[model samples]
Target: MRAISMQEFGGPEVLRIADVPIPQPRGAHHLLNVSRAGVNYADVHVRGNTYLAPVTLPYIPGNEVVGTTPDGQRFVGLTPGGGYAEQALVHRRVAWPVPDDISDDQAVALALQGQSAWHLLFTAAGLRAGERVVIPAAAGGVGSLAVQLAKRAGATVIALASTEQKRHVARDLGADAVVDSTADDLTDRIREAARGPVQVALEMTGGKVLQATLAALAPRGRLVVYGYASGEAATVVTHALMEKSLTVSGFWLPHLYGDRGALPTSMEELFQAVRDGDLKPIVGKIYPLGEASVAHSRLAARDHIGKLALDVTR
Candidate 1:
């Protein structure tokens, strides 16, 4: 099997393709023939050694894969490691049969980002119909799905993107209004779009963006911090939250999937949405397995919208 292995923590250049022995199933894990792998910010963090959990050297970075068994049963799910390879050892419980209506590339998109969006809106935020919600980075994988899912749940969504092109993508995905986060009047624009204080904020990028979104929250509102893409720690003023009765919390996908770790019910709903054409996972770019380093560079550049994937078959 050929895999992209990171021998040291550094830039995308560290991801080198190497021929390695194919892994076999151990205990509850199953051998997976990797067809496609989702390239995410999480992978970038892992490669740079900046993730919340420390990463061991000389390890494969991917976590999500769409692939099959030797018998040709196709599945899409999370992998413990080796997802960027031609084959991987996947936990049996995390893998699920891919719906016939969905393509392998699309299924790859749902593996992590779809699950994160579902959990962010329903589990972490407890979003309600007719409420106002603000989502930052709304044209990216999780944000794009969040915009669509939030709209489906009857929430008025204010999407924040960095460019006009991305904002247009957000609007097409059903965001009620879209704002450029780079704008000087970002907070004001968001408030105007929502027509009042926002009830739920799906915050990913930290730093000044987090500070702005925190100030825009309504009384008794909920703020879910899922990612710090800006690479800056967001500081919260408890007194500010106390004055408005606002609440703040953080969400991590791994923590949400407890002991048994089976794919949750929300995944089923998300897949059904795709089958019914109510949801679409955008595949912005696809690179061959050997070009893993370039994929990482594009993701790190942050100019692309939607999901970036590795085509292992190529």
Candidate 2:
């Protein structure tokens, strides 16, 4: 099997495609003939050595994929390092069966992002119907799914993106309103467009955007911080929280799956939504397995509108 490996972490250039031996599934683990691999910000972080977990050197970097197990069962789940290869292994407990209607590319794109968005809205934030929610980076993988899920939950969604093209993508995904975060007065614009305080804010970009999101939340409203795309993490001012009685929470998908034991349920709901046409992943670009480095560069540049995937079987 061919895989992309990083002997050392630094930049996109470090990712090198090389032929490697296929891995075998051990007890309770299943081997997958990877069809498509999901590319995430976490992969970029791992490549740059900024991941929360220390990734050993000379390792593959993808965390999730959609593929068939040794028994010919189709599923999706975390693969840690070897997902960038043609074949990988995932834990049986973490893997969920993919619907027949969902394509391999869509399955790969949605597995992690869909699960994360569902947990963030339904589980972590406890978003209620008729609530107003704001999602930053609304055209990205998680944000796109967040828009669809929030709308399905009956919440009015405000999507924030950097480009008009991205805003259009968000609008097509069913966002109630779109805000261009690159504009000078982003918070004011969001408030003006929303007509009131946002009840829930799904913040991915940290730094100034996170601060603005906190300011825009309604009293006692929740702000869920999931990622720091600005290359720097944001710190909340505790005193400000007291004044508004605001709730600030951080959501990490792995932690949510590990702590609440809701991974299977979330995956089931997301895949069902996909099957029913209520939810769909926006696949931005597809790259062959050998061009994994280029995919990483595209993700790092923030050039794609939605999820990028590696077509391993192609």
Candidate 3:
């Protein structure tokens, strides 16, 4: 089996292609002939050794993938060991049978990033119907799904994207409004674009964006911080939250994956949503398996939109 191996934590250049032994399944874990590996921001963190969970050396970095079993059952799932390979292992409990109508790309997209979006909005943030929500990085993998999922939950979504092309992508995904993510008056723009007070916000990009989004929140507003793509720490004031009655919550998919019903239920719902045409997973650039470095580079640089994947079959 060929996989992307990393011996040290550093930049994207650290990832390289290598031939490795195929992992055999134990207990209920299934061995998948992986066709496509889902590339995510978490994978970038894993490669750089900055992930919340410690990563072991001589590691192959990939969290999700879509492939077939020995019986030809197509499934998409979270691979804790590694997913960037010709074959990978996923416990049966965490794997979901891919819908016949869903493509490998869409199935893989729903694996990690999709699961994160679902949990962040409905669980962590406690999103309710008819509320206003802000989704930053509106064109990226998780952001694109967040925009769609927020709208499907009957929330008015205000999407933020750094480029016009990305903003347009958000609009097409049913975002109620779109704003320039890099605008100087971003906080004001988000406030102006909303129908009323901004009630719920998803803040992944850190630094000034976090501060601006926090400032734009209404009294009693809820903000969920999931990632800091800007590679900067967020400054939050305790006194401000107390005075405004605001809530700041953090979400990491790894922790949620441990819960019994978390991944299975959400994966089923996400796949069903995609199959029903109510939700669309944007499959962005596809890189050859050996070019994992390129994939990491593009993701870290925020150069791609929607879900980027590695075609192991290539």
Candidate 4:
């Protein structure tokens, strides 16, 4: 088996494709022949040693993947690490069958991002019909799905993206309003689009975007912070919460699956949505597993849109 390993965290150059033994499944765990592995911002954070969770040196990096078990059961789920390889072992209970309508690439991309978007809108934010929601980075993997899920929940979506092209993509994804965050006065544009403060905010970009998102929330509104893509984390202003009577919560999808006992139900709902054509991940780029370094470089450069995948078997 070939896997991407990093002896030390620093840059993309630290990733190397090397031969390694395939891992065996234990207990109820199943060994998957890795077909596609989703590359997330968290992967880059892990590779750069910026994530709060510590990583051991010479470790394989990947979180969510889509493949099959020894018996040929197609599934998607999270791995502790070590998914950037030819094969991965994961708990069978955590993995869900991929829908026939979804390709291997789409399944891998949705395993994490799609689930996160669903959980954030339905569970964490408690979004309801006719409410207005703002989704930052609406062109990215999770953001794209968030836009669709918000619409399905009957919420009017205000999508914030970095470029006009991405804004157009968000519109096509079902966002009622699209704002270019790269342009000056994003807060103003959001206000104009929504006609007032938004009821729910799906925030992934931190720092200035987080602050701006907080400022854009309606009274008693909720803002779910999922990632820090700005390369800088943001601090919440207590005054803002006090003034607007707003709620701010952080969403980590793995915690719900690992701790809240919601994996099975969540996966079921997401797969059903995909099968019904209500949800679909926007897969932007696919790279061979050996080109893990190149993939990381593209992510770091912010050149690609939506989810990037590693074709492990290729």
For model 2, give the 10-residue run with minimal summed lDDT: 252-261
What lDDT score belongs to each candidate, Candidate 1 first?
A: 0.88, 0.86, 0.90, 0.85
Q: Count the backbone clashes (under 3 Å) in each candidate.
A: 0, 0, 0, 0
lDDT by residue (tens digit), candidate 2, 1-314: 88988899888889888888788558978788988899899999999999877898889989898888768889887866788988888987777788777888778776788888998998888999999999988888999999998998899999999889999999999999999987767778888778989898988888888888788888898998888989777888899999999999888877754543688878778877887788988878999888888998988888688889898886
lDDT of 3 by residue, 1-314 (tens): 89998989899888889998889669888899999998888888888778988888999999899999999999998988589999999988788888788999888888888999999999999999999999999999999998989888899999999999999999999998999989898899999999556999999899999999998899999999999989899889999899889999998887876789888888888977887787898889999998889998999889798899999999
lDDT per residue for candidate 1 within 1-314, as digits (tens), equals: 78998899999899999888888669976677889999999999999888877788789889999988888988887875679999988777777888788899888888899999988999889999999999988999999999988988999999999999999999999999999898777778889999988999989889889989988889999999999888999899999989999999998887755535335587798888887777888988999998999999998889999999999988
- Cα TM-score per model: 0.97, 0.97, 0.97, 0.96
- Name every residue pair that clashes in candidate 3: none
Model 4 TM-score, 2 decimals: 0.96
Q: Order the candidate numbers by lDDT, best to worst.
A: 3, 1, 2, 4
Cα lDDT over the full model 1: 0.88
* Model 1 clash number: 0
lDDT of 4 by residue, 172-219 (tens): 999999998765577778889999989999887787878877888889
Best by lDDT: 3
Give candidate 2 regions above 4 Å deviation: 259-261
